[model samples]
Target: MSRVFEKRYALSRRALLRSVGGLGALTAMPLLSHEAFAQPVFRVYPFQLGVAAGDPQPDGFVIWTRLAPEPLDLGYGMPSEPVEVKWEVAADAGFRTVARSGTAVARPELGHSVHVEVAGLEPARPYWYRFTAGKERSLYGRARTTPLAGTDLQRVRFGVAGCQHYEQGYFTAYRKLAAEPDLDFVFCYGDYIYEYRGERLANGGTGPIETIRQHNEGEIYSLDDYRRRYAQYKMDADLQAAHAAAAWFTTWDDHEIDNNWVGDIDQDGTPAEVFRLRRQAAAQAYFENMPLRARSFPIGPSVQLYRRASYGRLLDLNLLDTRQYRTDQPCGDEWAATCAGVAAREAQVLGAAQEKWLLDSLSGSRARWKVLAQQIMMMDLDRAPGKAVGYNLDSWAGYAQPRDRLLRQIRDRRIENAIVITGDEHQNFAGELHLTGATPGPRPIASEFVVTSISSGGNGQDQRPDMIEIQRANPQLKFNNAQRGYMICDVTPERWESEFKVLDKVSDREGALSTRTKLAVAADDARVVSA
Candidate 1:
């Protein structure tokens, strides 16, 4: 569907759907055969993969469900043809007041997945949704629209979480996230699934970690492989519950395709041409599973995942694609001292176009808070604990010049309340941001809150000796924790409060969650402090 038609349809849908209730079943599109209108019979429940909603706008949000009668089977245990799936939106949980009802075709080309860009919803309100295929019914889901553009919001709450390796541990953190009652949305930072077959050495440095479970037979590369991998992850009940509980704002990092992949360059040095094919498959599989809008559909190896979402005059969320447009990681992409490559003027993390877009958006945004919901830590952290200085070349520290330029621009442009939420570190960090080359003396221009992994690092400790040494070395860091958990942020007009919710263990299914730390940044100040 073209954008022009979509807008027109959305404008008219509000009135059309008002009279649609109890008006009998709508006919299927004429392009299909008579059998398209017939009810399907399923041996297994088709909605085993569950339901989800994401990328909410003021008027509506996207609702998604894949028809997988047997998710583990090849082809998702569905016919190699299109199937009509029924969907409904209601104002109440019991679906007493139907808001919209329609039929969507689940096409085989997209692995029988359904992505319906629901429109005509009331702004800043909650809506209940569900799906039906034949005699099977999907689990009910709740989605909400943001406030109208420029609407003054007093407060908003959300969660930041990512990095769930299926083999490492159970998705207990996700279950905790799903139970958050007042979240407006969940910003999923990345590493939704690990590409490796099973538990491997942490960053290929630490010794091989034990696994509570196991991934499929091999590392995924082909389209079928990627699809099956996503199916396996989505089959988790905890993950499914999180998706159903709230709308999601998602973007992928390195593990979505390959570990430490740089643009078209694969980590193992696969040729760009060959790796592009792998990236194509990975991108398609990502879109098929994500509740993204039509505009984010993959074209070859590229998808426009860098976009902006505004929540009235309160927040401007710029979800960035750091992995897709980045130059190769400098200094061999490992923990090392800053090298000449790190200072190269040509090095890019957001690329030329994306960086310009981000700067321009930040400059023009009228929102009270400007958020960069992205992958990778932006703060230049010294990873080494002692006399020898080291940094992760895959992070912003790898491109020191670029990092300095971005921070300098933030300072020069006077972008107030600039906050960054990052993923992929598997360890929580609350840090103050400064120019990499600056002679820093507590003059931070921004703040960053890095959420830990969902279950990637197994059962992590509350604190480690090495981490203590590192934290002592970097005084700019306000707090750090090595645990499996996520972060919850509560934003108001005056202050932004962040709470680190940590789990004792993810290797086991039952562990209590606790708040490890709580920090806040005043609207006029960039430093993070105890709340």
Candidate 2:
């Protein structure tokens, strides 16, 4: 639900291996082509990776699938030619009332993927869809369109999450989310797949720096590698179930391409030109796998992201691309006793263009709540607890002026009820947004809720040692939980309620979920409080 799309627009990492192996046989069969569009094809199911819907507009949404009879293989066992993939949307799960139907070509360049942008239908309603190629048919997908723009609504329910390192743990959080019958949509804020070849790792400190499984190949630099990595991640039943359950608005973070990568700086010290190629491959694979429109598909190294989606007059969600345009982390990308260049005026995190766009949009917003769905923490989190401020340069704290500029826009325009829902740090955080990039200062102007990972960091405790330090260091923050899970938001005209949904364990598939706590932010007060 980021980029603009018309009806025709078109449209990981781990232990993952054992889990993926259970998906089915990796055996593949012979080729099928559009010339043989009428011929029966595929010995194995072509929709092995599953179906998903995204970029939902008022009138329609984009439904997607890939023809991968042998999912793990580079070619995915599809012929090197155009394949005609047909899709249909209906009013019932049984598809009794067919609403619209069309055909799309799965090109070889795009790894034989299908993206169907469906339109000319009712808004704010449920529709079921399926894809067909030859005699093989895909599982049905369910999608819901947004309400008409400017139309007032009673409520909105959604989930926010990301950072699922397959090898690190199971996707049980996604399973729980999918089962939630009340959710309207889900915002996936990146780290969709880890780029590192599955290398088994072990705990090095307090962080989830280890993995039970490793990447099958070394550092992925080719389009095929990216596609395969994505395929591997997609094999998870829980993840696929969530995709089928509700519409998703997704954006990328560091691991989707490379860890903590900024612009051409891949953090791995790859040259800008070399990293550009990798980025290009990663971007292309991302587009092919995602339920995005042709409007957002990549052209070489760049893809159009950072767009707005409105849920009637109740909410305006702005999905942002922070890693694509940001400058390298100031004073090196690490937590230090002090980072010197953090306050430089010219340093950009959102870049001048996106900054202007965000500021202008926030200033002009007429909705009750403006939520920024993005990667990385926007709140200034102190790495070292003390009176002398120490900051993590990898976040908004590194690009000081730009953050201040946006905060100033809010403070100046009185952009009431603007909140940021973020993902990255594998821990949940609820805080009041203050202009001071460093927290525990000034009056609250906006609010931020950083959702924990789906799995990435492995199973954690009810509390971590740093929680007390962080809370004491930054009073603006109201909550912190180092667990494996996500957050649920139930928004209404008067109050926005949040529940920190946590999982007792994510080391395997046998975990159960419970709410750690619930928070509420009154519409006008813009302060996080106990619900």
Candidate 3:
């Protein structure tokens, strides 16, 4: 049997402390009045957004929750005193015998959110945790720590989703995913929250119906607006439930700030300085709200979004940052003066530093599968012959020189079990990456799996004829489908399976999900096959 499925954690109480005595008790005395302490303690906001864990490592994982006095943020404008939150780990769902317990203060600066990274936990073992503040008690969340590095793990299962536009319909898809008992964790590729308003998209779309208060204060461009937007998205009961269900590894694409905007630039053509400030604000809000490590925090307009995560010897995920540093979009013929002068080789999608990191990581990885969790398609999908014209110039195809260089590295290094998982195209595609094309200089190298959006562009109902024509023109394309839903990727030592899980309908508010397609990659060949 595979160690991935058979792993277990032994429960043993390492430490325990209550507010009655100890350092936390002594610290809590001055902050709270006698009357406040006298009242019966209640875990009122036990787990406002449900218990969530993320950024897991072999030694530990981050456990999180928000302490809300009220169901919404109405009760307190801003919590003056730091709230002492308690957390525990157990071997079973019910904390019959607590293993570890600690106190963490929920600072008002972060809207009373508490994130506890419990270290020294046994690897590849399932554990349950919860948080408590006063009379309120949060729901118990289950999380599994990563297996020891290079362990011979056999199988791992996870769900990959993106572009969950709130106004389109209910989060029925997430509700369904939450109920699924098998997923180890959730990988939100991007567009977790659409920055646009309901009226902005031609319909009365409210963008995923959630309990969190909506951002009634116009389009979000500043730090405050971004914070409100995140709070609104987090309020969705289904989304909260899903978070409670498993840990999440996430990254952001353009919609998190502005659609299709490149480095330090604004989509509406705002001044460079003004746009850079906006980017900084948005980045700050993102860091504050997300369950990210301190390392991902924004430094000026840039956040280090690209990094690697491992799952024993089974898989290694290299999350890519595609939008942060890149040249502006290529202009049309009418604006040739602006586009023609731009140097294609000097232009890049991953930038120099990130690209170098990726190359180095790929060369040294020992996992059975090396997966690239990226934002856009890596395989070239040209819109016109000898001309760049598909999707947008922001994708890999737009920066041809860099794309070729990357492919050449893969070929030269002979990096085995390399796979690319992408989002942002609003369509599902399977392409056999030939590093060297017939007209090109070098030889063939990689493979790519581009997942369709959860709900974007109104379910991609209007298919582009040019896209279909282009597919026919390109022989490397194995599969293509424009749909609304996500992908469920199952990895094993022998093979990797990517199931295109699609919703029955997106136009209707209440619709079921189904597997529209399935593609598999054999361990030996690393080639995709229709299941």
Candidate 4:
């Protein structure tokens, strides 16, 4: 049958689906032919990979799901046909009162994934949602719209985490995060899954990181590999629980496509054309797996990820896309370089366009807190302890000109309460952003808290020796912790506070999560203060 005919093969319920009651009444709809509503050629639950929702506005949010019956199979054990998926949002979990409901086509071309943007609902209210594909019902998900864009709000809470390597350990930190009922949303800062082909990595210098599970086989070059990998991660109960507990806001760094990849360039040195194909495949899988809004829908290796999420009058979040527009690491990734190559002014992280967008957003924001939810460490951390300093070129420290430009804009524009939430260092840090990049006694233009990874590295210590050295050399630094877990931010009208929540260990499931330290920055002041 033709593509259009195959689409028409679905149960005829256009008029029935326009009403809320018709959604639940769809249980009896059947395929006209055996090939109409195709199923995987195996015994597996279609919703094994789980469901999620993200990018919530005051009126709506996006709900996501993929039909992966046999998750690891080359075809993800899903038939090569479109399936009808119905989603209903209710004010309560019991489905007694449906607020908004709709049906979406889970197409084979998009890996059988569904993204339904539920709209016209009440603002700042909690809603429960679930999907039904044929007879299989997905786990219900909890989501909330942001407060009306201009409402005078007092407080908001959220958790930030990323860099979860599947083999490193279990997602116990996510379990801890899922239990936090007060969180408005979760901010995932890149490296959600590693693309390595099961290469054994030493967790830290010389020490072997304990493994809980390993990757399927080789490096993921095709769509199937990435899909299988994502399905494997979603199958974890902790991650699923996290998704079920609240909505999520996410952005990608190096590992989503390839390590240290900038723009169209892949780190493995594949030709740009071939790498673009790989990138497109990776993006397809990412969109298939992530609970992102339609604005970030992938199209031939590109996706518009940088957008604003406003939460009433209390906060406006400018989620950035660091990897997509960044310059390749000046002196190669993950190394210290003091050469002139690092000093060149042409290096751009946000490209020219996104930088403008950010500055404009910052200037126009009327909220009490302006938060930049981005990836990477923004401080100029010196790796060398002497007069001639060496810096890591992989982070914002490498793109000094742009970093300085951004800080200057923050200062010149007088952006108040400009707080940056970050990750990808695998270690916690509380620091200030200074124009001169001198840590000691320099008044900060802005403040940032770099949240660590969930399980990217193995268990870490309370502090690293080099961090102490760096701290001594730089006084703007306030707190540092090397551990596995997430960071929680409490944003109020008058002040913003962050708790460095830590897991004692990720190498084993027994590690307890604790608040290692707390820090605060007043709304009027740009300096980080210990709470």
Quote the lDDT for 74 in model 2.
60
Alpha carbon lDDT of each predicted model? 0.85, 0.81, 0.70, 0.82
In model 2, the clashing pairs are 11-115, 11-116, 14-167, 15-167, 197-215, 198-214, 198-215, 199-214
Per residue, candidate 2 scores C-alpha lDDT tens digits across 201-305 of 766486646575566778787999999999988988899989998888889989989889998898778889999999999999998888876677787888778
Ordered from best to worst lDDT, the candidate numbers read 1, 4, 2, 3
Q: Mind sharing the TM-score for model 3?
A: 0.84
Candidate 1 lDDT over residue span 1-531, tens digit each: 211111111221112222112221122222322222446767677887899999999988989999887676677787665566889999999999999888777766788788887888899999999998777799899998999998999989999999999987899899999999889999999999888875443432365555678886589899988988999999999999999999999999988899999789988989899999999999989988998887788889998899998988989999999998899987777675767898899889999999999999999999999999999999887887666778888999888878989998999988889999998889999989988845446668999999999998778888777889888878788899989999999999899999999999987999789999999999979989999
Error (Å) of candidate 4 at residue 443 is 3.2
Show model 2 residue runs off by greater than 4 Å: 1-40, 204-210, 437-442
- Candidate 1's displacement at residue 340, Å, is 0.5
Model 4: how far is 187 from its true place, Å?
0.9
lDDT digits (tens) for residues 209-302 of candidate 3: 3322233446778776776677667777777777777778889998888888788776778898999898888887676666666567577888
TM-score of 2: 0.91
Candidate 3: list runs displaced more than 4 Å. Answer: 1-47, 68-77, 200-215, 332-343, 384-391, 435-444, 460-466, 507-509
Best of the two (3, 4) by TM-score: 4
